[model samples]
Target: MRGTLVLISLALVVAGVVLLRSKRPAWYWMTFGALVALVRIAFTYNSVMEACGLTVPPSRLRLMLARMARREVPPDRPPRLLRTRVTRTGLVLRLGLRPGQDAFDVAASTDRLRHSFRAYGVTSRELRAGVVELRMTGYDVLKRVQMPAKTERDVMRVPVALRDDGSIQYRDYRQIPHALNLGATQSGKSVYQRNLVKELAPQRVALVGIDCKQAVELAPLARRFSALADNPDDAVLLLEALVGRMVSTFHVIRREQRISADIPDAEITADIWGLPDKLRPVPVVVVIDEVAELALWANTMEKKRRDRIITALVRLAQLGRAAGIYLEVCGQRFGSELGDGITMLRAQLTGRTSHRVNDEASAKMAFGDISPDAVLSVQAISAERPGTAIVGDYSGGWYRTRTPHTTLRQAVTTCNDTAYLTPDLPELAAFRPVLPPLTPAGPPSLIKPRPRPVTE
Candidate 1:
């Protein structure tokens, strides 16, 4: 009982200190705290008396005096550390940071904090300069830590964190196009893809989807997709065509290069930004679902396809930047064992999004080498929230994000509305899977004689 009471006392003290450490509240630590201290000391009195064998009866007032004897003195002023902010867009959030801290440190610490708090439906990133952006992950535990700080935004871009001027902070992700998404099944891996697709659907970018899962998962968003491939064969074909398109596009820019003093400064570059509206090249965002499946084949024919696929993927990762071809590859796990190509591939993808995973390895595969605490955070993601994820990109840190559930129906509807945006590319249409044609039924089987009359 004595030991238990002592532990409780220490805990209470620590809790109070931690709570008051940041905020500027003097009275809270003074008057009200003094009263609480008195109550706590009085309870400790019985133990003290029992141990010391004192004759004096311990009273609340006496305990109050004892409490003050050991209380820590208030600091002169609170430490003026950098301030932080949280902003929301739908279920996604953006985090902003203080000036002194580097983005990496803040990102790592934020990853630890997210782990401790189990910020499910929470994905945070640091923006250019000193901002952290977050996307709400799909999970329930996130509600516990971030509920009080939440501000809802229905738009695609969520300025989750704030600036010194209290304005909405944002970042241009196009600056880093290659992204790697890693997580185990049922851990919100799929949710990240959904979020990206939803964000890019309305953009002028062309969408290329490679779903090794027979397109069953991505088919709903077909209307927005310029090309969708199920098998590695089709994926390879699609990539080959995409690569050809990129080369041609680059050549056109090179051939058309006629920089002059009359040209606007922004138009001096060779990228699509430099072109006229009609001739502007559409950026292609390639999404790979279950990339491991693409690497699993072993036969000679399969090996050839895999080699070509890896080479093409690497080319996109290496040189696709200038060509406006970005790759967003999603997998259950990303490891070096997949091949030397894996290491090369991981380098190109600057953005990383990790949902909850089953093991430490999965987390490590997703995040290069996260703190043990952050790895623990991945395990905390529950299966109930299918759309919640934690995203870590090149800029800041791992963040909790719960991408609001936009059903397949919703995605389909969005795509169907903008189907006209589908580019005119005959190569893509040639390999598209042929849906079965509906056959007309002959006039009732029992009335077959009617057909004979027509023949006569």
Candidate 2:
């Protein structure tokens, strides 16, 4: 009877764990997963390192000393575990490298360690000269997106998504002035853009949109846009107006550039951010919903229009950073097949994000030159997971990221609430969209009044 009772208790515990792991992953990690991972790491650390060939042979001095004392040969030395920290998601291990071992050696063996430790994932980075930090996750962060409580937000930086390793992924316009976002149809690209817009709505910045698809994607949030263009002709006009504004901003910066021997070289400012608050113009973010729409041209007149549009885009990508203008170019595919300047425009976009692309080539367009591994990672994104994306930049570092499911209604409400924060740019006044007044909701009248008959 006692043995039967023990078996039943063990089965019940196992069932509870399985249920918690599938349903409440965070709770599982806190109550059971973290403890198991810690115990595994402690027990399997040495053997896992040896099995993965991460153990370095002991120094000649130590071996010789052991032999001189008529003792057994010294075993290979694995990295010393300097510290271990348990986080909400997983464990952080700080390791002190052996003399012959480097961070790469440890990084290469992370897969083995992860499997041995039974972790969901593992990533390693050099913390300093002789130390490496390994971040292991106990659960798949992208499976259910719950953003961390603390995120780094700044003047032009917004946390747009949660990274696979339980860190926030920020969209920093200052660091990367231009970015390319690529995703196929039904890939949740629009949802990502909505999240971006909602985050930017409350900031004191000007938003200009070029949605050549009849503004269907951007029109819902038109209240927050300083300038909007829906067609090729109107888009050209808006681009010209933006160029004019950029030129004016440059002139302002030139005037304010007080270059004197008394002033330090660092103090001589060139960008708008360095100017006095009163003299500084508001920053502008230009979002292109479909870059392909602007690049594709059929006839002679259309070719000229396309050339003009591409030229303006190239100029903005090349010089707009210094004038407080940034670009967020989104499309299904932006390749050489699009046009002549398509590759050039792409080269200038340092930040790249690829959603579930239709083909390997589409993924390559975003991450080919930066990270070949990232291309493979992008291709691995399943169509079933729409918002999951591989995000990378010029630094060649990439991460799996997923934006939480944000409804269009929520984005529109956020924009409407923060509409007053939109900056007024005089140059874009002519292109501003005029939206109809909203009707107020009210209770239905119980007694219907007699309608006016034959009034006309």
Candidate 3:
């Protein structure tokens, strides 16, 4: 209505200038439009707050507090809003907890708050000693792509996707060396991988891939990979080779360490990061697609091979960080039931992202122990919302997030463009697979032309 009034007012002004030759009525209409907009906001503000249960009438608060202080049975005193910080995305409400209220109470009421306000989503966090922060997302943040702003290059930080708050979420592989990205088939899991791979392609890093599924997902991006393994046998070999590299890297670190007069003994280094740039080993990012296929066993022989693979990966997870090796483990579902060492592997993966899943169990497998609330958030993601996910870290920081749509062709093109930039890793040269080019579609030529050429 306000927009319509504004348009009508503009039309009236144009008519007065062109036809009537009188500006008086045009000014009146413009004033009316402005008033309508202000009045609409004023009228809806109170009702919107009331509907969201955000407004606390002073009389009701006093009565409720009095009853609670008098030892009422329920003791249902509502939390008082202390203040709010408005931002472009939404407002952050800071609430003062009542006698028996806590941060969890506000967090538990997020569903109700979301429904009442008709908001896209709501999240809560604890602030200052006793305050609870309720961050309400006012709009559908995941409806479009939220690209990251360009900043100075930081090799350790790779911008992955956008959080609901419009801030870029980075995968700090240097700090969190390993990550577990979980989502069902076509749940935008591959898109996340594409973002990571494309971002890392030009960096001074070695890319290695283990795709046990159809091999179509990572195979196309092989131009950027230092080594590519399509089956379990090759995966085992590649993993073992990585383990050798890790041991050798540690050996170099030990040899390079020296007790300097100015440097403290505690600051002595044992990682490739401590070495000079020219002398530092090229960092390796190991991508494992469908880790479950590598873990699942079919026969005695397969079980042994799986055990070796798991042990190698466990060692990599435990000690690979200092050696400048990182893992990006992608799978549909990850759980303790997968195998013996699966739980150990998961514990090392501090960063987790769970996209749309077929069941709550899969979501829990990714974040249950880390944060139960994150599991609920992941459960709320419908099948229609493929890219929507819950991302969290070991510090209990979790939020709803989504990656932008990146086609397979784009990802492949990115890899191809940066293929010439792939760093040489002497340790992985033997394991690198040289894939054969696609054969032509036509039949082979006959050998009947040899006699005619000789006669000529």
Candidate 4:
């Protein structure tokens, strides 16, 4: 990977130089032609200097002009960010490179450039070319990079420098099992979650929501969910059942594994429904609303509940990666204040996103090390920017994305549209919430959509 990335980075340099040299019109070339006088003087002097004994040839010496030209590109077009913003955390300058320029080349010349960028306050990873192909990450060194929130996108959706194809060149959720979503209340947190859930819902993945807010938050989309947990006690029981189900499925996979040797490696994986009926291992994505609620217990019973839930979450975060059991844990706050094991739980989450938060501390907790400046942006999030958010998957650091709102009605509609696609699984069916059946045990009657409330 390292060798491949380095070669790709160098190629970008050559490509960018070609593009930049070509993009200019004749007048610029005329200006370049004027420099021929100075070029001849230096070229002649260098040729003579090497004539006696110097090993470095004038040909190699001429190539040095490209190196100098490469460095000149940045000083010519310094990014137009606020000076204070530029001097803050992990990045120094957010200059735009030519379409094919490689950031790794710039970063490699002197760790000083990267170090200086970080020293002077710019922190987000350098954005590189290839935006369409990577969808999120395109740069060799920038795969782990993140930039500041200059625009709404930077604050809401992570700007993945892809190859302009909308396709991801790197990892996606199917590959990363755990996602930690952290933001202060009203930080567009729910908006982000809705976008993710909206995408996965139609894919036939069994959606399980743990909404301890009496299911009020996620209840509207019950049509799409295979299970929803409302209160603490019920959520505890539900989670335990999920763990039990996982244990059983693992056993099934193990028994089958004896012959898995005969099967392809691709077939060895297990999910909530992929196990043979024998091993029904369909992938399970558990959406937890207010993980703090589940992790915090007021009493001994709640503590035990918290312990069990934490244990299950830890297991899922640790072992579920291969089993296709993914987690989407959302909360207004996730910190050491929640007490034991919360930090551990947060560690399990590989992907994280934060909307505008109430304070820098919350942002720091969610995005501190990877993006402290991003945390600063999170504090400014308000209701007006409902669908916008900051998403950091490390797929390309953090990006501000405006996740189009997936309203309760829209979600219900989408879920219903895709409900039939949800294959029936006996184990999953056992966990479904009993909603007292919509027909009320009477003859079938026509139903009407509830009318919306009007403003006075």
lDDT of 4 by residue, 179-281 (tens): 7777666655675566556555555467888998888877876766888888877787777777776777677677665454467776664543345643456
- The Cα error of candidate 4 at residue 45, in Å, is 30
> After aligning candidate 3 to the native by TM-score, how far in Å is the CA of 360 from where it should be?
2.7
Q: What is the per-residue lDDT of model 3 for residues 1-456, given as tens digits with 9 covering 90 to 100?
A: 999999999999777554522333223323443343334434554554445444443556667776879954442335665776654445566778655455776676788776765555778889866788877665555766556456334776777787886566788888889999999988899899988898787677889999997577888888889988889998998899999999999988888787689877765788898787666888899999989999999999999999999999999999999999999999998998888999999999988998888898998888888988898989898777668889998887798888888888888777776766666677778757566654545786675433111100
By lDDT: ranked, best first:
2, 3, 1, 4
**Who is ahead in lDDT, 1 or 3?**
3
Q: Estimate the overall C-alpha local distance difference test score of candidate 1.
A: 0.60
Residue range with the least summed lDDT across 10 consecutive positions in model 3:
447-456
Q: How large is the C-alpha RMSD of every model relative to the true structure?
A: 15.3, 6.8, 12.1, 15.6
Instruction: Give candidate 2's root-mean-square deviation (CA, Å).
Output: 6.8
Winner on lDDT between 3 and 4 is 3
Model 2 residue pairs with clashes: none
Q: How high is the CA lDDT of each candidate model?
A: 0.60, 0.89, 0.78, 0.57
Better of 1 and 3 by TM-score: 3
TM-score of 3: 0.74
Instruction: Order the candidate numbers by TM-score, best to worst.
Output: 2, 3, 1, 4
lDDT per residue (tens digit) for residues 98-211 in model 2? 887888888888888888888889999898999999999999988989887877677889889988778789999999999999999989798899899988887878899999
Assess every candidate by TM-score. Answer: 0.62, 0.93, 0.74, 0.60
Query: What is residue 353's positional error in candidate 1, in angstroms?
Result: 0.8
Better by lDDT, candidate 4 or 2: 2
**Candidate 2 TM-score over all chains jointly:** 0.93
